[model samples]
Target: MNSRITSEIFEATAEPDPEAGLFLNVATNGLAVLDRLGLRERIVDKGHRSPHLIMWSSTGKRLGTVPNGPARDPERGSVVVRRGILHHVLRDAVREAGIPVTFGARLDRIEQADAAVRAFFADGRTADGDLLVGADGVGSPTRRHIDADAPSPAYSGLVGLGGVARVPGLAPTPEAQHMVFGRRSFFGYLVRHDGEVYWFANVTHPAADRDALRAVTAEEWLAVLRELHADDPYPVPEILRHAAGELGGYPIDDLVHVPHWSRGRVVAVGDAVHATSPSAGQGASLALEDAITLARCLRDAPDHATAFAEYQRLRQPRVEAVVGYARAINRQKRVTRSRLGIAIRDAMLPMFLRKAADDTRNDWLYNHEIAWQGSPVGGRR
Candidate 1:
């Protein structure tokens, strides 16, 4: 989900790689979408295993283990790829389709009419369309145009910092992602088979200013990171000490609720409506799925209005569920100091993992298959 820790491809699967570390059970949640764009098989073939998610307490005690996801190939699991590669693949597809992409166009307002929707830009340029698919992202003006009164995204009271480093002490295992609940923060890392480690740390910070946070220097942030994981484990400090360059940090935010996804002829998709937090690791996957479903709805429905309604009806429920799941995971990643709380958390996590072993536990989520025929999964066409 993070754009910063980009690389070729790794395994983000249902098992953990002891030699590599750990990562979320990132499955092929949006393979169908990529397939439509003729990019799924190519991306998967280049991907690798991100096997297991291993949790540890601040003192380095093994808390529990969970498969990256269920119904995955136990021997291999989901393939992983760099975010940039996906972008490049999509860009190539767009180029092949001869779609004109206008960069540096600042959207100002939405002018809607009975037959079409026009997006007014600050540069006096306008793009009129039968339907405006607002994939602009979080802080989307299209979303705002849908409902001016909609509340902004909520802050999670945390700052996220990550970097790609060559940590020789870290064993090479691209298939694994490791998470450590530290004394005052959350730390996670996974190394590719080439010994290049992709690592991140989440610290409790009340500030939300992007400019000020970006101004913080590498040495300063490294010192802060050093203290957060100082007492956690052996290689924690070693990894930080060997970082490649400056640490990039950003305020954590999530769109828990959106007042209106569609108004007149404009409809929002992906992070534009329900922006999932990074904790879920489904941000990109969910967005890809949204694009596919929205396109299908529009194709199946006779008119733009019906298409927008059907799209929202089918998607609103699923995105809400995923957002709730991400919130629950976010709480666990936040800094914790209570002894009883920590003990209860440590105990319940394993139990939850055990229950998650049931094939049906995540069926509503991971089991979603894109149907290209029949009534489909949405409302009446």
Candidate 2:
């Protein structure tokens, strides 16, 4: 089927910023989908191979390691890349496939007919097609169009901040990313072969005070981060001190459940439907899974209604499961001032990690494979 993409961005250029600090950890499952589209090599080439996540405590003690993805093929594990570079690669791939893209076409409303759907943009343009997919994200207008009472994104009680920095003589973290649960916040970093460090911190903040948090200047935020990690470890402080450019900051929000994913010819995908916290590192991978599954359902089902139902049936359970898992991790990252609580968490985390590593608990997540050529799981028409 032919498709068209519309973006609110004023320009069609993919690289919004060459030095954008935002990064994504695309798991093996996500890479599998890219491989199916013949774009895996192109995307992975621009990323660092991150195969394991190593956790540390505020006192600099190792809290065991968890495989970033499945261990079946070590080479095909998770990869860390700047979000802008990933977007550029995918944008190029879409262009190469001859799919037309319209920029600055923000959706103002959607009109649906029995046999077709029409999208009205704020810029006085309209596009008609057999279906309208809402990949617009957490603040999706299409979501409300499908169901007026759709649930709004819930703040994850964490304000995320990060930036790229160069630390002279810093050793590269080969095939791994380091995470530290600090006294006041949670920090993660990965070093590239070129000595450039990609780091991010999740600070515990009240959801009601998001606006106040946003009002803080970048320099002030950096200073707060430095003090948060000052007594934690060596590199955490050093990385924040040398952070380059304007650091990116945003309130991490997620949607665990949405009553309706589709109404008529319009359907939501990715963050528009079910968004997860970055704690589990499954946001991008789950979205890719949705794309592959939805395409197969559309191809195999007899009609659009059947396709949409089957797509939701196949996706909702898995998506909700992952979101819940991420929420659990987010709770662990929440700052605890009580010394007893902190001691309990530090002691229990190692045991939990050991069990998880021994049993391959995340197999259901990273080992998921999309059967593109197979018929839809449910034989409904």
Candidate 3:
């Protein structure tokens, strides 16, 4: 079988600096997919083990501890790695597999016939295939090609900024990430064994203010963050103070649902169909799950249409559930200005955490395993 990957970038390469790009928390479920693909060890080697999330209030009160990955296998928990490193690992794996990757081939439109599909690129090039899978991310044009009425990505009303910094004298947060619900923002950071801190801050804002947020300079954003986290507990302010090198910022967005995942010979996967906020840290993992599932569907199903239908049917519910879960977390991370609300949250959070821990509520998410053996039981729609 022949496979090809088309990317919009001029060159298919990852950021050279290890700590330069966004950090991804790849849950065990995502690691499981990489394990299936024989790349799990490579990813784990490049990342820090993050199995737990320790929550805290602005007043330095430890809120509670939550498991970040499945409790069943404590040894193999989530791994936090730089996005660029993950990309490099996956890209190298693809190259080793001899898959042809065509960089700078931005899709302009899709033309479909009874028997095949053609992707027309902006560079006056075209590629024919039996089916076209759109992994083009949240702003996927292929999604529109499948269904012009597909829902646009909705802003989560939170502005996200993060960077890596080496803060001396900081103790390593082994196997955990610390989350602080600050007075005006949410700050999360994890220190590697080497004392390098990977940190991010989420500031609440109106969706309409995205353009304004984007217009702010990196230095300006850093200043804003310092102010927001000024009165917060230890390390947040310090992390911001020492932050250097490419600080990334964006308005966090998610697609609650896309009505059409596929049309004719075209199908959408990953953020194209279902996008979740960064709160749950499952966005990358869910995309990995989609890749494995879609491959299995196409391999086992008799035809492309059946494969697409089965893939959507199997995946839509799981991804939507995850999105809902992340949305709930996003609500918690939003700035709580009311003292009463803050007090109430702080008072009730321990109980909530206890209940969640007792019941192992997130097992469904982190423990998800893709079984690639059987053919899908759905017929052509």
Candidate 4:
């Protein structure tokens, strides 16, 4: 997604480091689209997992043991991607681009007027821009500084536990698998290329009290995870048995509403504007979409004001739809003693999946692109 969007505004930064991350499943599908467009070359073993640049020379022999699950369609031949792998790959590529990337830097203030934005950082220096995009995460400093009263993300009454498990001969058939048992749920998929099985489960009960959730000792946290997955499908127990104490927990939250996503010269995108639940799996994809769309809008509009409007015009409906869908999915995960309800809910998934695929295929999105000429901000048309 980032590759597709970035190519529209800038030259290919570097051939995509496919080996730097896990590539398999739906994520690879999107990546393959970019690769086929000649924007990148898929690399093998790009060296992820740490900053140490370790390569997986033993991948070939261990490849057969990989669990290809239902979530992936071998027929589609899409790339499987891991969240961490994408982050590391994109982070390294961005740094190598000489595009002035910064980490751990804090923004202190934002001043915007006359179609320009100046962001002041804690270092007592400021970066001025013809356009400013708040690609920050859910607790966006830009959103707060720009609109203190803008809608905030609220806990969606759920918590998620995620981890990677290595169970030697227990590979799943197909590519990826999602199992919703009662109100709780589990989603597992094999990341292609990297050869690891990653899974996440949603627990909607007990709506973790943030303070209590964080207060638990490491041992207590593991106990809680085991308790949550006790009734889940095969190997969930075994997966817990080998679980690394790396376990962590956080309350899930979503933006119920946001009156304004852009104001004056400052505009917000992604989680900063509409943070949806992970149950939707569109959070990162949506954010990447925002970055590219914002660039395109600013490039195509007659001026900053027009571009801002165009940005909202193109994104609002799509974000709202996802937010609504996310909330609805959350409702399903909260099931309790509702057998009839579960049956009906299960019946709706196929329809929901179809709609989601259609949403991505819509012309207003996925198909939108901007030419790679002119300044990053002035390349309209």
Candidate 5:
């Protein structure tokens, strides 16, 4: 979802293949704006409910649920589908706008002059434009060229593994995201109505080199997951045992403080400048927000300098706040590494859920709206 796609985008992308094809359900924070944009027909709410969280202890006991909250509840939202398919839908939107997406064009270096910015690629290709938007993800070459001294992504001391499995007996939990706080780590899975289970687990172990991670086979990792959730809940170990297709793990990393989001004619967006842990479910949403906002700034601002400055000024604070919030959530998910910590966490989780359950608290994290056709908002600072 573009959150609030401009009129041109909305008209051009009247029919997106991904949205028209996939039937999977995903719960999110901001579908109301999509609904308001007359795109609500794209959201398929078969049985998935919004604003529901279900956590289980290692031994299979239900901890509790936070029904609806200022933190979890957004205005009539939550859309679900395979993320790859979601990418397709977005790609269709871009294609509809007549923007071509090219692959295999790796950046080798950057060269800019007073009037135009040009990027030289490793493949001996070059592209030039008035401005370059670097959305090349966390390892963005654009970010480096924008500010050579920009900080690297900080590792969060956790490893993440996820896979999807099909079991006909499995019943859909709808929009509820199921999390397991195991004795040694964390495991989470949710059953879709189709009995398809989307699962992910986090292990709080020592950080290893990327080569080390590459050497571990899926079976080897699954064995470790078996041990991690050996004493945990019913499906925790079972899901790992039933893991299908490319089970992989990587260190959870985030860009806590980006020194420069925009410099001169180059501007970075999404994970390029503000990569957040997946715990908060805002990374994709924030990036989508960045896309619309950046477009608005460039369209309305009098000059490229003002547009770049305004984009960074408007987005930096919000992204930083989300980084901190997700870090907090990441700590909670990884806290189960110790026995004492697990006991304390399990005991206090109910209280924690209660405090976050209140609405009308003016929570800005999930409630911020975009001014699509006007100047960007909240840039006074």
Candidate 6:
């Protein structure tokens, strides 16, 4: 949601900077940026602090993504935390900064007034705000209220399984032994903060029986994976063979279009407006970008209407490009077929990676910064 990128698109121009880590930084630091701006707080809870953070590996190997400081992984490109965790962190921060929170208080409706957002809740509660950001996710009531004709999210024809296990850290070789099974499926190995090993598998499935998936025990999942991936590379079978407890399975979905992101005083962000397939691993990053950009535009615009216009103006094209990329990558991930399909996939991966690099290079999303003005607090109300 950086204006640099947004403005470039509006002017039919290209971004000046498109480094690999540009958007990655914005995604990871979005909450931290808001906290630093005094709009939120830095929270530290004992059991689970950031619920939305997903430690993963795009290739599904010992290459799982973990939180890092200044140094970063060179080969995996950019890394960002999941959206839920980012939201939790920011919510906690905002609370500490004197913003109240309404949990389990689902929004039933959002009605825009001349100068404020009148949001009604399921429990018949309501709140008024000069600006409203719909980060409520894929089935966002905010989006529904704003645009009843907004397109619904569609399945991307891919499903994923994620799990954590304790393995011989030295045996698997987190860096060296992390293996991939080509285009068939993705397998990963990760080391948790508590020294537990973690792994995830990206598989293509036509329809997911949620109950059947969760009903199976971890050992059962291993057996199923073993049978499905008999022809895969070495560690994939081995990793699943050693999987423990319940394995997690989830479907991937994409939202192709949303007519208008902003209408009067309400503006949707993240999956609320442009939910995307996970194949591109940009969902969280995109949401983080939305949060930062929304804050920046709302602060800069002279009025709420202007701010909403600017927000949509800045986010639409970039989000559309990203959504297209996610769908395309999902097509490759969902391939399960003839020898011809296998051969084409085998040859297309490298080309795909190269094109991905190029596409990101011509964008400014990676260079976003959460702009904070005034006392880093109540400058805009």
RMSD score of candidate 2 (Å): 3.2
* Positional deviation of residue 282's Cα in model 1 after best superposition, in angstroms: 0.8
Runs in model 5 with CA error above 4 Å?
1-50, 67-75, 359-362, 374-381
Candidate 5, residues 154-261, lDDT tens digits: the string is 888888877788765566776577878888888877787778777888888677477898798878888888887888877777777777666668877899788778
lDDT of each: 0.70, 0.83, 0.83, 0.54, 0.69, 0.55
Clashing pairs in 2: none
As a whole number from 0 to 100, the lDDT of residue 244 in candidate 5 is 65
Q: What tens digits encode model 1's per-residue C-alpha lDDT throughout 1-381?
A: 111221111111323222222222235566655776788776665455664666777777766655554434444344456554565566667667666566657778889989977888777877777667778777788899999997788778788787778876678765567788877788887777777777888898876888988889978898899877788775677888887565667787889788688999888888889987777677777788788777777777777678788878888888888888888888888766777877777677667665443344553555456665675853221
Model 2, 41-63: lDDT tens digits are 98788898998888998889889
- Candidate 3 lDDT, tens digit per residue, 141-249? 8899998888898888898889989888999999899999898899999999999899999989876465676688899988889998999999888998899766777
TM-score, predicted candidate 3 vs. hidden true structure = 0.92
Q: What's model 5's overall lDDT? A: 0.69
Report the Cα lDDT for residue 21, model 3.
Answer: 56
Reference-based TM-score of each model: 0.85, 0.93, 0.92, 0.71, 0.86, 0.70
Itemize residue pairs with steric clashes in candidate 3: none
Candidate 6 off by > 4 Å: 1-77, 80-88, 169-184, 192-195, 208-223, 348-365, 368-381
Using alpha carbons, what is the TM-score of model 5? 0.86
